[model samples]
Target: MTTPTSSTVLVPRIRGALAHSDRIVLPQSVLEQLLSEAGRESLPSPLTFRVFNPATNAYTHCGVREFSAPESTVLISPQIASTLGVSEKQLQASSTQDGSTPPVLLVSKCDLPKGTFVSLCPLDTNYLTMDDNWKALLESALQASYTTLTEGQTFSIVNPATREAITLLVNNLQPEKAVCIVETDLTVDITAMSEDHAWKSVAHRDAKRKVESGKVATISQDAPVRGTFSDLSQVFLFDLKSWDRSRPVIVELEVLDAGDSSERDIDGRAADVFVSIDEHPSKDYFLWSTQTDEKNVISIAPSNSFLATAEKITLAVRSCVVPLSFSLMVSQEEGIVEQKSAPAPQSESRQCPNCKQLFPPRTFQLHTAFCERNNLLCPHLGCGRIFRRQDGIPASHWHCDLDSFSCDSVSTKEKHILAHHTLATCVCGESFPSQQHLAHHRATICPQKLHICRFCHLRLPQESRDSQSDLLAGYTGHEFRCGTRTTDCPRCNRIVKLRDLDSHMQLHELQRVSAPLPRICANALCVRVIDDDPAAANSNSLGLCSSCFGPLYSPMHDPTGARLKGRIERRYFIQLTTGCKRSYCTNPACVTGRTNSNLPKLAPAEVAAMVKELTEGGKLEFCVDDGMTRRRRLVNWIGDDNEFARPWICRAVGEVRVGGEDDDPTSSEAKARSWLVENGVRITEVR
Candidate 1:
């Protein structure tokens, strides 16, 4: 953090107004005297500086960028004033106010250190004679154009498709001696300033990949050949190698010189010329492709599956724009030939109005003078092909007077007029017109595109930019804060959020399949339930309400319900011969609400034979209310019988509300003894 606040300034070279020579600018009162001598209020993140100069005593470092230069001057970049030898006529005689104290430099406030390895060296070898991948485009253009590296300082960069400047040379940094590449990551390397420039940059990148491995070649099966396309020959290959793994070859292709008319360019590049075949020329290994309109033909199939376990297929092809010509061939499929019902003699032929082919009337006058003087033919209209007049034509075949297209190369009509009339832009500031409409607006709907997130799985930018409550719930602000996390709800344990837990478990599976059912307490020994009070008291037969059949209420009119089955057999013969002595009766056919009082107490003729065998099969369910039969047999023997006594039985026969309480004018017995206290139905009561 070396900040003793030094200043001195005046190096001011600034040619082409700075776009990073490792940045500089300064002088707004020397950044307010180095932010008030470093107690700092603003200028820091990557604020560096250092500079030095004393007439080639050389020094460098840099960073800052814009304090609006002039006062004691600084400005820099003419490659940081030619790396400190500073003297564009001594910065134009110190910006002439008839004054001359110029080349001073020494600027201060440094910090430096963060470099983690650098190296660099190019100084020519045009990024090793560029075929692209120029060391990952010079490490993403030195991390998007430098912030400070220094060592021996050289810098340049350019080459956006051969604008060609290149330069480089920093050569070695690691832990210090001028480093701070702002937010560090460095590791670069590249090397070669001598070993005869690393053997002429690996012999000019192995003689342009040995002329791109002598343009692919191999091809065999049925012969047919012919080819073209050039900007260093856009792809081509061929191979196949003796197949026969149980027959199937095919392969085809036809075009024969086609280009300009399938119209495209605004960066989607086309203008007719197409060709494609694949097994890897990299459209991510696409397979068959064609496109030169008016039927240009293309094929592949030998049961493709990478040609049934490829030991050799290769093909490739590729194209897009160039002096496109084609033909190829391959053939194979045969085995299985028998039908000889005789009918063979046909080979008469004629056709050739200049390479239309079909010859034989005894070599139709020597194949029309060797196809009109070594073939040529193509005058465009439905383009037939031929070409070979010693391969000359394509120097700049034109067409597009703004989209009429054709273009064989003046660098494909200046890349089809800079991809369809120049405009471009988009790293997401969006502008378009070409580069194929900013690559179809960054591959369709570019809200800064990128994507991945699906709830913070991270890659980002599908742009809904969160919080206005996830942009009003349409989400994408990193999946609305990764759907605010939360969770629980495996069907209502309730916590929720993970993006509204799938509409909160789809509203609990739509209220568990449209809810309804649980009306309960028709007293199969009553574990309550009923009160959804639209003025309570549901009319009853024994769907009991009036306090569970109001102690067998009697304003009796019977209507052959055999007097309500003799009042439910006299309330189970008074709860089995005198024992409603209720201790919150847990009725196991109630003797004294039997909690197993050591059996044997029956006697009065076994209490009329246990009340005629517990009221025979008339199924008179034993009378309820002893605190709802001990809370319905303690929730049918302790809980969850389908979440609390589902259809509880132990002595059935239910329906017993004969005829009174005016057929339930909101029946009473204290509103059915607190109709399960407004039907909230939880259990716990037995005290």
Candidate 2:
């Protein structure tokens, strides 16, 4: 066979995807040329190629990702470019005979050994601080981005959840310096780059914990902290570690001063400030977050799961402008009595009509002259604040023309208009007045919100409920339909709806736990449980099922039980004298079972004596039947101890139950022997 080979210019993949992978893209012309050179209809699957950078004198193996590059130009991933010491400088246009072109790498078809083991070392310890399940995430990232491995090469893996990137260097490889990772089971060992790196990682984690723990403010009952935020990003951490957590604490935030809004537009579009109480430093486990425009006295009871185990409560604030002042108080939920101040003594004064201010009667006229010229009353309805007329209302005091909201600052007015007047539409086609409303609508009530289906295990948009019944049933429309698909229950062998399967299986489990175990057939060789038939439950005396006790059953009555014992004796006599002579018989109590099992059979006189002795005890087992039911019992019993009995039982039950036409007495024994051979039921000698 001819080897396919080609030379092409390698350039770093600047724009498109697979930037972290080792796969490369080649020109379509190169692929066609390689195919023609090999004299084959198609190129081999997962085409492996060796790329050589002549300028750097370096080489690396790669897998083809696509054949859609520009003519004579190959697009190698950044990882591959780094591996071969190729840089973007080589991709710069050069003055050539055909205008401008730069190609500095050679590509050729080659075979590589499959990888068996690899050792990787992370460049830093940032990956150690990731979630505990990050190892699986790393493996997934590696699988998605790599097709080959080489020693001394470095690659980066990005976390999809947090978008954090960590670089790893290939430290060692087994079987070869480079190996094809396609369809190979590789043993991977991951370690920190060095011992010093591990120590630094630990130190970094401890330092972060110390900072967070030290920043938390402790609160006591009835005592509140007055806080001020200079900016929106300011966060206040508090802890109730010293207080009794058993009693619910009410965390209250009273806005003392909203600050000057006209200074600048608020950082957010909603409320001026948002307060939340969370357990985690990241606030991932928040108990409550401000959901409405309740800025006056926002009181939240920290009574959720976070309050039980949280060491610290993080009070995060997101706001529009700075210099915001608020009073944060934590008190017992039931004991908050408002304190009423004593009425202030009435002051003897005269009311000034111009600025609505009370002044001393002595200088009333003089005060009025200055107040009337310098101070001006607000012209807006319900707003009587007086400002200096010379400063032209200060430019900070403004009122909305459309609503009854009047506040200080032009930015606050703009924010109010945007929050209450501007309309926003969600992707689900619902419209809201503000972004905050839209966000809340999408998170809580949107039917198109993505949710994982419990039955189908697929992520899909939640479907609208068909009716109130569906809502009461706690199922989405998708779940209702998905649960309609039926599956056979292995325990009861009954078809049950997926939605009801849990309860049905639970019912079965309850029955199993509460009901008594079924009694085994009286026959020592039989493995069948005694059936609850009329003969087996009411009349049978040996605890045997109808099938096992049917032959000896009769309506004849004997006062002394002599006839019953005689029948049992006769059954044993027949087993010893004629012998069932079947190979599967393994009962140690029966003469036929012993004989077929390679044990010496008793003589006729000895058999008679043994039968008499057994019947004298008023109990005996019938084991001479060659019926299908009897054979099934034996098969089940053997299956418990022998792995090879399953196929034989399957074939034996199928043949006897489904196709029993050959039971013509003369051919019955021959058919049984033939079945033993076909089903591979070996007749082993008794030990």
Candidate 3:
């Protein structure tokens, strides 16, 4: 669709300009300018140019003999004016400095030989018709062109270059040989419409009473057509372009269904008739009947509250594509129209056992059934007593702990329900009443089944698109690769998901291997000052533990992988005199614990051996804890995974040595004392 190579400056027509009957009088200056625009060596005699009419979609070779006016302008005859979607008065009208008469906007974008039709219809109408009656053509069609026009018939016309179309209309028929000539006003007959478009609007609907030319319009219901009609309430056909009737084009109309006069409601408003997508009686989406403004138009989109995706709607609507015609009837509601409704009676009520409150008899069984099963309390205001199940009846006695249970709660009752009530479980591990429910959930609500566009944040289920060509165009960003994808860190051995590679490369902390020294800050960061750090190692604030003992270190993979020391420090109390176990059970001695029978203490070597046997047998594990401002030991591990450790192991490892400075952490006796208490063992018989 390239543009034409000619530009014309239109000027007003004046009297006594050497204009011929068929030729458009033009000045020499204007003619030369136009020829130059067309890139011609010389102007052709009776020069011809192509013009476009968007409304009637007509494109033909038209000649220009000459032109006129003081300034460079184009003044064509009325016939040419009408063909180009402009009025004759427009080209002939005088232009002031302020442009009293606005210039027509040309649709042509270029000044080339084979030009494009770039003009729009000056008139509001996007459509028009042609007929053979010369007299009538000028009268009705504004002298554009005509073939033949009959009443109550539709015709298709389009601008070949612009593709703008009009479904031509002829409301009433008049035959040449008719013996009887009726004097009634004619109505506008809608012959056909373009495919994939919707039509509505009370103004267009009421034009049915006007002539096919739409010259005369009225609001009367008196004009009769050849049919037995009942106030325009019918399912009209939509002339689909194709023969596939899988999903019909939905007609949305808002109207009031007038009921019998005696059954009218107190408000006198008409009963609204509507269709629901979900089939809920009260949740209707499409209006069945109604009246509105004359300008109201029908919606071409699918029904509201429709669960289908956009692609589904486009495909479904396109499946029933109708390129030719569709049925249309509009009911105008100038004011409120009332309809009557049948009376509805109330149901009988009964009492509840929990609160002795009244409920409808029909709903009482359902109300009590679930309550008794779930141990629910009376929901009535001011009543909190629970209901018990006794022979299918709700017995009262306890209170409801409603907050303690939910659908996901795995209680004894829920376990019993799952094992006994449901026969199958879904892939997501949820129980349903029947296979049908399970299948529906899997198809519609399953998280695993949800399709998300990797290119964007659009989460959608599987569905088709509106146009394959359109889908291919505009965007090339969608990528849908699923499942776990991991890659080894380029710098470190740590593995990371492919998508998180960018963030993983940012870990500067993993670059260094740290061997943490087992020294407390005494700065209150440690739960209890386990022990003061060696001045040399504590200065750098980076090292590994070598002093602590216990199984708390297991499970936690220390990057440095430090091994256990042969002997660890401990709290040892030599017996200066015999004393009760409770006397020493306050601090570190509590780690050793007590028993029903009195026992003697054990040597450190014996205690260490017991610890070795128990831990090696997979009986114990350990971990580490950092201290906080007011609290020490057992900090929450939620922020970091490594903070989780066995509580008993930490208690055993954090021993305050009561021995003389002469004792060393590597001493077998010291290790023995710590291991016994760490395992909560009494040194009794071994001593």
Candidate 4:
């Protein structure tokens, strides 16, 4: 909403001297100056107007108005007059309207500058109604006008022809209703308004003075003065323009002391007084007071309707300040200090078994069980005995002696009890009452089936189905031999079993190689001759054969017949000394002739050959001491030696005869000689 600018008017400027003290006082000149300034200034001219009717107490709208020289007037149109229920003759007949029915004038103007007086002159009397609606309208209008006047910008009107100016100073206006016109000189700018604005400060100062002097200062001529109702917690309704002190307009609220009875004052004194007010009906407003103060005040708006309904404003009073004497007395009666508890009793001391150190009685008991299980004994080695816990049992109860033969004599019943009554049964359909009985029966009483090797008499399981039986059976016959490729048995004319072949060869008698023969004896003394089995006449024979005088010479022998001679010697020794009737060499290297002679010589060739012959013939025998019989025999021999022979040997072997004294020394020699003569007739030899 832009403010409209009024039409400009023309005026003259006159400069003249006045008769009083050289001051410019020309009436016509001053009038001309005013007119010129007014002409240059564009003022607000009303587009519509209102006139108040006193008799009816209502506002009627009049027609549009424009600014005129020496007067601000409204041009009342016939339509406007008819609409307002008034005649144009009445409006034209009056230069100024009656106070009861004044007209509202509007002018088109920019926002006024600070301190500029801008009046809404000829205001309608209908605006004075105390009705709520009228009051609200009046308030709104006042606020709006005030806002317009206080706008920061300044406005000026100038006449283009004469260059005369009018600077408007209209930025001062109260926000409330204007009951009277105020006139003041332009002083300060509107843009710099503060809380202490000039008009408000003056008002506050004037109000304060009025209050101190016991006079009721009204905020406005039409509103009532607000009075404090601290006498009690009550509400008050006030007219801001009048200074009327009337009865409260709202419901009375109960007042009560709010402070605690035992609370202390700032100086550490007991409190006996307090102040309080009841909860207000409107939660936005409340009453409050300090404990030290005995009065209460209710918070309410001057214009609130409920304030007028209060019957009385009563301030509940109680002593809030505490007495110092009362505080000291209470302290004396209650006793201010606290008491502490006494310490607990200490336990007695005792010795620890593990470390042999003293410890508290309770500690020893707690650790003794653990110490006993670990076998800690007294530190003194001479007495290194384990400490028994103090249970009421004899030392024998836990004896560890193992020398007693009692364990051997424990009965079968005891054994059964110890073995948890477990019984044993044999595969042969025999059963025993306990494990001990079963063990004894299996070891001694049971008829165990046995398989014996015919040659070695070694026991074997009856269930064995291997060729061991055949091997054993073959060994008992004269014609049997192991089928192994080499080392055949001479007497039986068969190969020995694989395992016995090497040992059997070591005992062969016939021309057997004593030490393995060299391939061709590097010593040039050994002879090589392979045996031909006469029993194998069906097979090819290339090597030499045995004869009475020498080897039956094979065509394959050495041309010089040296090997034949060696063969004859070997055969002779084997037959004559070994008493072997067989004719085959059983040595492995002799059969293959791959031996090295650097190794040590073995047993004599004749003995080896005889042994071999006996073994092959199934006639070899040995005497092995049976473990039970030999042990018994050894025990008897040892006992006899210890009883008789050892004593005799000890006496006879170490005894020494000492010679007699001088007189009998020659006699001793003569006796020795006599003894030699008696025993062997060697008396001359001794001489």
Candidate 5:
């Protein structure tokens, strides 16, 4: 597929939609996509619509609707509105800022042939209530489709009666969300990550960049901006005020919290740093884009520098999806540098006698390491490789050619290298950066891009393109997935525009259930094309193969399918049918084992059964891994020999529970107190 541009799209997911109508309504964008795949050909008898949720890797089939679902919404009844006490009337009904009216809690009652049904009840009245501040936060979160807040984690809300955050945890926020509760142990902490990596608001930009009435005019120096994979939240806008338009500009980069450059360092840590300069008015257009390595200081020389441009530079970073970014604006007035100078160098100061400059606090440690004038000799004893303090400062990533200038301090040596290093020029008479940068220039953005995409009619300006055929590989693989592009044929010497390939080829990915192109059922023995073949979609097939249809794994139709499907008789046939389907579950005892892999593609119910057998029947050994919950067992599971499970788990309620729990812990109060003290928890009370 052609690279999808970075974007945040809001796709509405409706719950309780079936509560009001037989047909499922959806936004125009979603409907168009659905029609493109599922609703393509002739409408089937007793039409069905299937939707696959990639997040859960599951599909939902609904009864079809002939007319379009209008206005990017699913409307519930006014009575429902009264029931919910929420109205999206003020939310513009936009795809982004819309939400469900409210939530109705459900309880299960197992009193049917098929099984238990989860129906709403008056006693299941624990919905949600929030104050104005919380309401805004929740609204914003829902708009962004935040996983934690919208997924029914117990969010402590301000109690209207007591004005205190309540500790009531809510559950089952699916399809749509409109309820909340206080956080609990079961409430998954979606924000699980290391200190360096957490989804959080890190930095703030000058609001004036977009809105004139923006409160902040400049990026907060104190704040560190954070970005994501798609959004470059941190962009440092730098204005080149140099009078000479043709002259190149130098850009400096500083890594914050880039651990100690002193004795120990975190320089080896992997970081994806993007440094791109805005070249043209077109948003995605870029004049220059390159990445940096190492955490130490470095300066980049870039051409095509402009003056007073609204948007200029950007600094976005990523450690995969967890992204971080920071913005900076550089402005310099003519002769302004001379006016805002520091005090003259003093002999008593950390400033070396020869360098005649003051060191920023961050660099003082490194600067003092090799400054011979201040008598701070290299830590490497007897290696009298010293230089005038003048040759050191602003550690640059340059290496010295001379072997004599070997200072033990890395920063000091780096400075000397830059001072003594010579610039290399390209064949085009353009001065190139150091060797590595020159190599990178040769690879990407090398003015003379030869290999071109025949489809996109675009030049491949990346590294190392061998022959025309090698470049064609990229065009065919990367450029020609879905869109239209202009391609030039090498052998035929002909240029033609390519049409959108998705129009004809997208049926293979059809997820929704409706009438469309022919497709063989996933079953190996069953070669049924339910859409194209009329007989395939009949009641006999149940719109699926005999084996698949027999499973009838729709939770919508059967609420207690697990208990029903797990019966011994059903299990034998189900395994036999699935065994032929694939290498999943080939236990000869259950079904005719086929294929060597013998992978068990257990259905949800089957998994629950296996787990039950393992735990209850003691079919497997259990230690820390709980046989039932699969979670680490409680500390009482801890023995005198079990060092790992003996420690008290800090419960959110502030109760310390071991495997023995609160009461059993008093029996081993001495042991518990000793353990607590060893772990640095003050032993306030043992009994």
Candidate 6:
């Protein structure tokens, strides 16, 4: 086996000969064309080959095949060609018949599957040399297709001869996964003089050991440690389990300059230091100045250790000092010492010349001058004392010493003569020579009196007399007096005095009565009597008496005429009977009863007219003597009376014919009454 020499493969022009088709066949001519194209291009070893089928608009997989140099016609394996649906002849013919040249076929290149081999092809050629440009074009086309495919995509290849296209599809394409990397640094510092100095270093070493041991290290404080720093720093923290560094926590410190005051006081000085740490980075540190001024001397615990630590840690302290200077002088000659003796004590007491009160000598003398100017005398009235003047003793300063009145002359003492005896009389006529006596008189000697009214038992000042009559007039002769003095007696018709009227009426056997009881008239008119009757008090016509029954059947007045006394209560009854004959109540309780001897006799003409109307079915009646029968008739009339008759009468007369063909010469009584009313007879006053 000799090594084949390299030669360029030429790419054939793809034209109408291999136009796209919906049902593509991989002919042996097409396979040979691919192999020839690969050899002529002198493509690199392990090159990719692809083929597209217009028939499914998809690429199909073909196995890798080795290329052997320039003029050799490449042949595809029978298995691969069969898988590709091509014949051996077609594969061989795809290469050149000329010894130095390569055969070609124009065919759609979309037949290969993604990442699968289709056919061997050269990487170099006229077209292949322009791979950069073509690659860009292909990428743009692929991007466009991919974008379209991603957005409701459908793909197809056009068959030039049939003018039809086949479709291809891919559901989804996996994207490339990403990996990210981040870096950080952390820094740390240690101050050996801090109280946790050894612990801090141990913690740091332990943390490192933990990292090496693949155990996670957490910086939880056993006790919080406070410290100070002068510059900015960075801190690092590491995750020992992962051995990964976290981002650096940066801390910045502010610089402070102490002025020229040199007394450094460190009492109660404090600060806070922040430290940050991260894995894969350094640690950062910062200082905060929290120091406070020392106000007073304060003793701190474990002073020696604290001072030593403070000195080593460069802590600021204030210095305070008080400076002093001294000088001394000495006299020449004898170096001597001196001694002295004690003085004797003196008595100190004096009495005031005025009151004889004892006091210290110095105080007494000082008070004496003031006492003399203000005339301070003894308050004892019996002594009648007066203070003596500094110049001459006054006579009033002498006091009486004798027991008898005539011999009780004032006597002089060493201080002064007692004078001006107190008087026994007080302004209020009480005697008191002293305030104590006067107070006793006021308490036991004053008099007071109060006066009261005798009648009403009301209290009043002794000086007021105006209320006497009002208090005296409350008595009444009777237990209850009558309230009516202006009203007349119903029986005697006399006005009774309010106070004596009840007793005066009792003399006449008249109890102070209310108005006499009301009674219905026994007359035919049945009038009601509201006035009191002395006669009815003794007699009975069912308590109505004789006067009301006398005028029953009188022709002088209409028997049915409404008596004024009765109509007072029967106005509406009268109005209902406007055109009808007046009604007569013949009940024995009425004045028109049969027993009334003064009943007036009616005329024969009147009796005949009433009898005619009564027989003609009109409402007319005459008083009769039958008591029970008359009562029954009165009750029936009251029951049967239609109070709606007046309006009926008005309607009948309103249709009456006057001087007309249908006129009646005989007028009805209603028409006569209407004529009378029209001729100025007052209907309301008719009696």
Winner on TM-score between 2 and 3 is 2
lDDT of each: 0.59, 0.63, 0.33, 0.30, 0.33, 0.30
lDDT for model 6: 0.30
Query: After superposition on all CA atoms, how large is the RMSD of candidate 2?
Result: 14.6
TM-score of each: 0.26, 0.48, 0.17, 0.13, 0.21, 0.12
In model 3, where do residues sit more than 4 Å from their true spots? 1-271, 274-606, 618-687
Count the clashes in each prediction.
9, 4, 70, 47, 14, 71
- Residue 448 deviation, candidate 3, in Å? 37
lDDT by residue (1-687, candidate 3, tens digit) is 334433445535432222211234445665556666668465433344444454456532344454443344555544345434465455545444555553432323211232211111112244332212212322222112222232222333333212354444333344321111112232323323333222322344455424232221121222211111132222221212221123323322212221221232111111111222211111011222111211113333322333332222111000011111221232323323333564453457776675455677788998776655656554545545444434322321122243222111122223223322445555546767644345344444433333343333333222323345423432212221221356687656678765456546644333221212333322222332343334333332223233322221345545553332221111122211222244323122122232222344455675555545543453221222312211232222211233223222233334443233354434623453344333332222122
lDDT (10s digit) by residue, model 2, range 1-687: 224356657474544468788888888887777777668467666678888878788888788888897776787777787778755555454223454556578888877888999999888766765655566656656665787887888888775434467889999999998888877888888876788987887798777566432366776668987766675555666665555565555556665554333345332222332333322232121334443333433344445454564555555443345656666676665544344785554488778888777777889999999988798898776787887787777666667787676666555666666656778886657787766666455544456654556786654556677788777777888788778989998667899999888889878756534434345566654444453445576567777767778888779877787787777877788777776666656554566678667788787778777787777765555564455435555456445655334444334433544223344543443454455444333334111
lDDT per residue (tens digit) for residues 1-687 in model 4: 323222221111112211001011112332343356569775333222223333334333221212333333333333223333444445544434443333333323222222333333111122121222322322222221222232222222222112233233333444321111112242232221344454554575565444331232222322222232232222222112212223211211222211322132222111221111211111111232222121222223334443343332222222222211211000111222333564443457666656555667766776766776654564433333454445323222121132111111122123224222456675446776644455344332333322233333333212222346534543322112212325456545676765466456556522232223212111111121222224323222222212222233456747676665455445434433433222222222232111222323334674467445643453212211122122223323333534322212111211211122232434433443333222221212222
Model 4 RMSD to the real structure?
61.4
Which candidate model has the greater TM-score, 3 or 6?
A: 3
lDDT of 6 at 620: 19
Candidate 6 weakest lDDT stretch, 10 residues: 176-185
Clashing pairs in 2: 262-409, 262-410, 266-320, 267-320
Candidate 6 wrongly placed segments (more than 4 Å): 1-516, 522-527, 530-548, 551-687
Which stretches of model 4 miss by more than 4 angstroms? 1-687
User: Which candidate number has the best TM-score?
Assistant: 2
Per-residue CA lDDT of model 6 for 1-687, tens digit only, reads 112222222322222422221122233444466567568675332222333333334333222233332242223333223334444454444544555423231233222222211111111122222212333322322322221112112233332112233333322322211000001111112123334744564575566444321232232212221222322221212221211112211121221211211232111111112111111211111111111112111112222222222211111111111111111111111222222453333456676776655677768878887766755564545453444445343333333353211111121121111111333443335555533344333322221111122322222112222334422542121111212225565547788754445556665443212212234333333222313345554443233334533332233543454552243223223222321231333322223332243444444464444344433442213233333233333323322433322322222232332223343434433453443233222223323
Candidate 1 clashes between residue pairs 3 or more apart in a chain or in different chains: 260-406, 266-436, 267-435, 267-436, 268-436, 400-405, 466-477, 541-657, 547-672
> Which candidate model has the greater TM-score, 1 or 4?
1
